[model samples]
Target: METKKCTSRQSHFAKKRYILYDVNPLEGFNLRRDVYVRIATFLKRLNAEDKQYQWILVLPPWGPLYHWQSNHIGSQIQLKWGMFFDIESLRKYIPVMEMHEFISDYPVNNGKTTIDIIYQLRNDKNMYETGIFKEKNMIVSCSNGPVSYKIIHDQQYTGFFWGYSNISSYDLQCLIFHGTILNLKNNFNPNLYRSIMFDHMEIPLHYTYGSTEYWEARRSMRYNSILYNIAYNFTSKYINLMEHMDLICDLKNNQGKNLSQKPPQTPVTHGFDLTVNGIAFIVNFLDHFTETYLVIIDAHTKWPKVLNLKKIMEAYGLLEKFKCLLARYDSPIHVVTDGGPQLSSASSLSIEASSSCV
Candidate 1:
């Protein structure tokens, strides 16, 4: 649990190259300390023999960062050195496994693998405060040092197939490969394919209300076709798709039942004014006022859209007018009010009036 920091100067004979390994502590089998010790011993032997290679084993947050740091001591040890790298353990972080899957499936090869951790970036306010990360993917260099690179064409197709946004997919893929080479140059041994695919199978499909329309339309087109059957075959295994299909069935059943219900509510009158805060309060003594008048306008209608008060006053006026008129006249009166300056100043008075009444 102790925090440890290790600083090493650039070797005179050793190029500033490293290989980075992204080790997930929460993953399958945890490597024992003894195993790492043996690896370190082997790496020391390699360094002593002048094999200009360095290997850094990234440990999960749960793993011992200090143990690795303490094991490799002194400045004489050059060429090759083995160290434990545990970002997750240090930060108590959970890497975005799903995004890594999509990137892993991305068909690209630039000698480095880039995992689009955009989903993780979304949860970080500082990383995406402007919403740019939501619309674009972030590419972190998985490599140890800086490197230039390009993605393989097939990987780009994979990104498109996975429905990654264009800008995000391309940039993220490039960043992954570039990061990999950079990490290698920094003397860290990062497993590009393994790290990229860490949480692939468990990655969830992007779901949202906007996607509902697309899914519904797709389901409708496939309902009676061979394509439908094919889709069913593929989607039946996924719980989300199955649940969506059940929802569609329920919706269809509800629609059928609704066809036999009472007719929909319809407003009989067009426009009137209600002035709890308007001139209507001052003009309440107008004997012409009838309870059945449906439309009620307010004075604040001229205000900006964001400041427009709720039409509660108008609604209350209409209801009270209807009750009083029905009791007194035993009939309905279509209430009409002057299209006052405030109401007329705004657009779509007819729509607003109708909506308020209902």
Candidate 2:
């Protein structure tokens, strides 16, 4: 049999061919020769159509080598190679795409389901000027659920094991402050957004136990400090300096107990007791701000008759008084009714200047 010379056209399309030798002839009979022949035939068809393709041939552990070439004369080619007995060993060469067709059906936007992109951005260490619109918009457009464990585990480990655990609660409190600053900086400074994210991060931690317990515990321990620092630095650089002490005070007072318990009780002027609705309103106000002011206009008399301040001072002195009482252990002063109206100017000045003294 004469070996035909290779042509330039054949060489142009068949750039590379990979061949594998098997040690076991029996296995080789099943996989190497048969699979390689099929692949070669497929490549030949593609080449005939002027399409370029790569071919990989797998050889059994041991084999009588079979040759295939367009120019080769007789088909009786055979040569001894090596041996292969382990079926598991064959696994490495198998095409992984055949394992599951569902993987191919995954949505195009499924990459967001993994943590890869988020962590990549985070690891870049460049401070991003991200707004709520961008973050929320990305989340809405994403086809996947929250980030997967594979994506966040590395950052979690790094944040936990790497001395970040040692960060103080006060610093974490600072971060909360900065988050406010950032919110204002973004021009859509909604406290609700931060509140929701914090709640989302916390509720799960509260229930997690055992192995997950450690993760939650570590997260809880570091969450405030890390978030505070991030928020503070980001806000300070990009937004206005926020008055976050009031917010912090509110969170601390409401965590497990009543605001009144934390602060001194003040006497209601005009000797009038508050209705349940009024009390509820006051509590709700405290939940958002440390102070509130109330001007009790007598509905029957059709005139503003009484002024009450919370602890902190603002136009709404009632709410401010409430905040101040929470912050400091001041004696609650009761106002006694005097029909004489001897010092009306003095009373107005005192109410107006309450915040100034603080």
Candidate 3:
């Protein structure tokens, strides 16, 4: 099980490393999400225990799922992570990078990025047949393993790689693993390989299945704002209309008895509408400084307040500014925003944000 060490030029002084992974191609979307929680917990522990290196998780792309039966949407392969989940919200739990970003940042040669090694995970057949299991992470021979990967040329192994043809690995090894996710850290050699991939990540179980960290990771996986808007729009357009129609029919049958003497309640406090400028301004070293404005509105009064900033802020800074804005009126119970990255990340602190509701 010897793998030739492939070191990066910056490995001499680099303190950052990437962990890329994938589930079995047959695994469904829900199971893939569970694997993510396990990986997030593992990465968190890796960063805490190993102070010398910072570990970042590279998210696998989605598409061509066996369950996705719709034929009109065309090919769903190679879809980015942001299209389904809130990427910024994911970062609140663990550092994550999209596949495209990883490909761009990773060193490439001849239009291909070679992974240092690929650990092909397989089940322990003996334990499954005998109904007896023991924790293990043993390197087995790949000669009789699954034939998902093959050596293409120049000793580079090629496989699905999430449908990307440009990605390959220098070596492949079969691992018979039966343990928690954290146990896989024993396979890492940060000094030799800056990047590694796990082909069958779904085999490992979570370190703590129902602990606080597990729940935190699960909550951070919020659906994209677009999905929320679609659901809200459907409810507003169809469900509300059906309710109104039922009310009209009731009034026709019951007459004035069904009429209410009081009006609907209007939220006076704890209602906010947030938005950022549509465009950004970049200025030279002169008096005209770069600026972006954040606008906050009172949902009940339709009143607006503008906050100026030298530049667009990230999640942490945006959260601070949002807290100051909320203080002027009171603690926010519900807030609405357009679901942009910064606003969505900030609102995720206490409430979920969308165009219609928070």
Winner by TM-score: 3
Residue 225 deviation, candidate 1, in Å?
Answer: 68
lDDT string, candidate 3, 239-285, tens digits: 63222111010010011122111112322121211111001111111
Return the TM-score for candidate 3, rounded to 2 decimals.
0.67
* Candidate 1 lDDT over residue span 1-358, tens digit each: 0110011122234332221122222233223332223233333333444454432222212223323344455432111111222222211111111233323433333433333221111122343465443222344443533222235564421232222233222223222221111122222222222122111111112222224332222221111223323433444344332221110100111112221111123121212222111111111211223322122221222111121122434655545543442332222111223323222221221122223321
| Reference-based TM-score of each model | 0.16, 0.15, 0.67
- Where does candidate 3 stray beyond 4 Å? 1-5, 240-331, 335-358
lDDT of 2 by residue, 246-325 (tens): 11111111122222221123223222222210111112122326645343332111233223344544446554554454
For each candidate in turn, give its C-alpha RMSD to the true structure in angstroms: 25.4, 31.4, 17.1
Better of 2 and 3 by TM-score: 3
Specify the poorest-scoring 10-residue window by lDDT in model 1. Answer: 246-255
Q: Rank the candidates by TM-score, best first.
A: 3, 1, 2
